[model samples]
Target chain A: MTAAVAEPGPTDAPLLRVRGLDKHFGPVQALYHVDLDLPSGKVTALCGDNGAGKSVLTKCIAGIYQPDHAEFLWEGHPAHIRSARDASRLGIETVYQDLALADNLDIVQNMFLGRERTSRGLLDEDSMERAAGETLASLRVTTVKSIRQPVASLSGGQRQSVAVAKAVMWNSKLVIMDEPTAALGVVQTKMVLDLIRRLRDRGLAVMVISHNLNDVFEVADRIAVMYLGRLVVQGDAATFDRQSVVEYMTTGAAGRPGGPRAKES
Target chain B: MAGALPERAPDLTAAPEAIAAELPPEVVAQSLGEYVRAYTARIRAGESGVLPVIVAMVAIMVVFEAISPNHVFLSPVNLVNLFQQSAVIMVLAMAEGFALVIGEIDLSVGFVGALGAAITVQLVQPLTTNWPWWAAILAGLFACAVFGAIQGTLVTRLRLPSFIVTLAGFLIANGLFLKVLLLGPFSGYPNLAGQSINLQVVYYLMWGSIDPVISWIGAAVVVIGLGLFMWLGDARRRSSGLVAPPVSLTLVKIGLIAVIAIVVVGICNTNRANLGTLEGVPWVIPIVLAVLGAWTVLLQRTTYGRYVYAIGGNPEATRRAGVNLAVVRTVAFTLCSFTAGVGMLLYASLLGGMSNNVQGGQYVLYAVAAAVIGGTSLFGGRGKPLHGILGGLVIGGIYNGMYLQGLSVEWEYIVTGLVLLAAVIIDSVSRRGSSSGSVTRV
Candidate 1:
């Protein structure tokens, strides 16, 4: 593609727009006509009870599952993400809940796990170490003792930081984190929430999946709550309070019989 | 789930310079004293690395030297013979190291290796194929690699357990080895003692020695090269503000290498012959070292090696990283078998021929035992080729010392079995102390 073709589309458009996404497994429907918008430089929290289709939608966007019907607009252009590689090629990176880090490898090694840089058939350790350090520093993650420390030695927050740093280091335009702080302690959860805000401040589109509403309110600029395989409400963080969001999460609707369903962006 | 806000959110709006200034040092210190303290802390944390293995090795050497009949275990002749005898198992351990690092085991390496040795010996027989020594060796290694690929494919593609696949491979290879030895104009064995210069070179692989002068020169070159490589690389990383070992640590490591090389060469250069001047470094010693050096680089400096470790630690993570798990696993098996071929070639040289009577099963046990005793975690993702070398030496020392004491083969098995159990216990205990205890598999 030429330079002109490289520029995706208009700058102000949402970085990733998902419309009418549907997914099913045999006779069961997991996600139903899910509509979502992930704007750049903002954090959009995805909230749902278990099996409420939050993960199913994230996996669809991550190219881990083939949606039965979906329309994707990546960076303001119609794009197809058929594989995880395809999503990565489009500058979309996912930090799964498991963290997907090799425990035996050091921080730098885990950061550049698959896409390791090599020179003359040898791993360029110096360059990787420098780059990983710079990325961590940019994220203001100074809690870890050393980048060379093996991942198993890291605290839960430090591991999450490494995972996020890995995602952001790939020149990613959009980052989707699945429950970034599920198992973290108080201080560790604070560290990861701060990291999520930093990603948003860096002007990257961030989609966070979390069951913890406190973490959601701490970093999320916009929140989308799902129930029974449907997006009950999607709006700015200011539009909904904790009780409203919780009600929407469990009952598929907030206040009244026909309250605000899909508020204007 | 709701929770209270943090007591104080760290200042995210601070300048980059401010954050950098508050950052902790990558290493605890740059001086020798601080370096030792950090090392002790790490060891106490259960990341003792090769220290335990080295200590175990020294303990083995000391005990054997003190108790062997006439104290022959420490004699120069016996030491050199021990080195030669240990060569094959050391290489086999290295072969197993490849598969072990990838969280798999190649139970077939012993027989796979014997099959390769059989092929090499058969081809080099003047009355038969009459191939050159080098070509025959390559062919034999290739045969082993092919077998590895076949077994690897079954394990990776068919999703069969590696233990079962390689165990079946072990039986098939044992049968094939016998059949290959009986091919053409041979009975049940192929001897390497013939009128061919190629055959002589192959024989010299185990029985011959380098000239004293040449051995000294080679030792100097190796020591200097290795020392310079380590010192310069670490120095550059330190200068560039990267994570590197302390200057004192690098120098100490280099010094250790130099001391080891000098001692080994000095002992090997002395006259050990009761009748004539039959002293120099054995050819097999360098052969084993060369394999160790090459495999060390492959595992440490290559992307494939990184993937192997990653896969071993967490296969799902590796797959999520877009690494082809099947390909990496298959290649690991291939390299395992190929290295085993090298070990078997050395085995043939030591025995002076290839035959069906080789104890392939016992050798496989020795291979696993060596890797484990050398501090390689059987749980995977924590091993090195050097572990195989140290472990191999321990196995060889025990075997030689038992022979010196006139112990039966049964004792060798019993002692090795006990040693293997001790190693696995140490591994499991240390892992529990350091990380999450998930030792459900051997």
Candidate 2:
């Protein structure tokens, strides 16, 4: 395993470097020349509208679909992830919007699902339960009463937390969360936002894909805006103002030189 | 002061250990109470415990014995008869349970059993230039497995609902049965060869004393092996920091197995006849037990079993989990059909021949009912082959007891239908209650 080092410059070395990412379904290009860098221990937000290629980029990164043309770099080395399992093996975990949880299974069972620890054949329920409890608590998810409780019983926010905890349980280096708080109530949303911060604090690189500017502003260190298959802007979240982001999102040419842009919405 | 974003605080302190020592006592207590409530709710909703079902069956038997003035039903001979008669159904139920656990149903068990029997008889007949009985039996089982695999493939790969797939299988099997029978002089109906191959197999199996020592030993071995496996498995799990059933719970399970085994041996040892030379356990019992054991291990200990459960519980989740959903689904269907085939072979072995009116439909219904009653959820993701044994025994008891009372066949169907409906209703209600209760707890 490569040492997890924080990159000092934009071009120093990216943990995951994407160059000229392009995807086409028939004649419509879903992504075009999309270049981005996901550095270690930093939270990068991929922000876009419904059809602005946010999902396309996520799917490409997570190995759900192969990009028509692109290069994926890990530790400045070319990496080819053929499947989700391959991505997982490379310490890349994607938590989709659905959370992909088994509702009937309890927290411990869900947490250890597919990759359960077993002893002499039978499920090692106690160890998994203990580990799950530890993971949830370490992540400051104190809202859950029991690790034995079913995921279906949890609030949307708690479910999201569990999803993240599951990803982080296997020592994931990069956790990509797609709209972590989209369906959550205000309190639940706050809980999930706090979880995103906690993940970053744990020295894990976090990628949050969302259209909610408030959430991005609260938890993200950098924001990458995509519009109609091309990345329009990539900058530190602290440097960009809300008005300028909206301007870039609507019209690709924010304060930059001539660029094909969308009409302001 | 601009706040300076809290100065990007760096933790000079080492990271805390990941696992917590313990949760608050109140929370633990609350969670325990919730578990108890959920279990109770499930029981009330129609997830009938095996113990209760067994108790009810025994109680029904006692009641019938009391009502029959001649005490005919309680006669040791009749008791033994009950075992023999229920053996085929019990085996069929166990077979169906295999499929049910993976969230599929086998509707062709009855016809498949008939087909297997017909093949077995044909292969072993002297005029057909009889093959060794063991070899014939193997061929019969293999044929059934192949048949099942075909059905399984169609259902899994084609993405067809199992109900439709098996229903078509039921028809095809029945047609094959008639076609095979018509091809020979045994034309309209078939009988065992001049000498009974079934009786030969049964004699060899029950070859010892009035209380076959081998049978007793076999029963003891099964009980002890199962008990030790479960207990030790649980202990190892707990030691490794896994959630395991409490030690007391494990002991209770062992005790249940012991009791059931002892009772079965005791019943078999009882002298049921004043006339006729027949006493010890039937040859079919051990065979059924072995089949049950093998099926149980297959569904509980293998990656294939886990994939089956995963697919049944949530196919999309299983797919995302990187399991090939099609392969698992197809295999589950095939296993289900294969079990149906095994059930047919057992049926033929028990009866010694195939009949034109083999009650394929009726037996299929009972097999499904047995699975559901045994607590193998119709909606899937929660079941075991053992449930089929419990449920099958219950249905078998009813059939035997009712027939002994000289009850009409129609009445038997009515009773079975009522029981099946009751079981299904209970399943749905319990599932709903548990899900809702879980939501409340959350």
Note the Cα lDDT for every prediction shown.
0.86, 0.71
The list of candidate 2 runs beyond 4 A from truth reads: A1-11, A106-109, A116-155, A241-247, A250-265, B1-38, B41-59, B62-75, B183-189, B193-199, B202-210, B238-241, B437-442
Off by over 4 Å in 1: A5-8, A257-259, A263-265, B1-29, B436-442
lDDT of 2: 0.71
Recovery fraction of native interface contacts for candidate 1: 0.47
Model 2 C-alpha lDDT per residue in residues B64-123, reported as the tens digit of each score: 788764877767666666766666676778777667766788888888767766676666
Task: Give the worst 10-residue stretch by lDDT in candidate 2 chain A.
Answer: A256-265
Error of 1 at B337 (Å): 0.8
Residue B170, candidate 2: Cα error in Å is: 1.7
Question: Model 2, range A48-108, lDDT digits (tens) per residue?
Answer: 7668999889988898988888888877777887678778878899998888887656677
Query: In lDDT terms, which candidate is top?
Result: 1
List CA RMSD, all candidates.
5.1, 7.3
Which candidate's DockQ is highest? Answer: 1
DockQ, 0 to 1 scale, candidate 2? 0.28
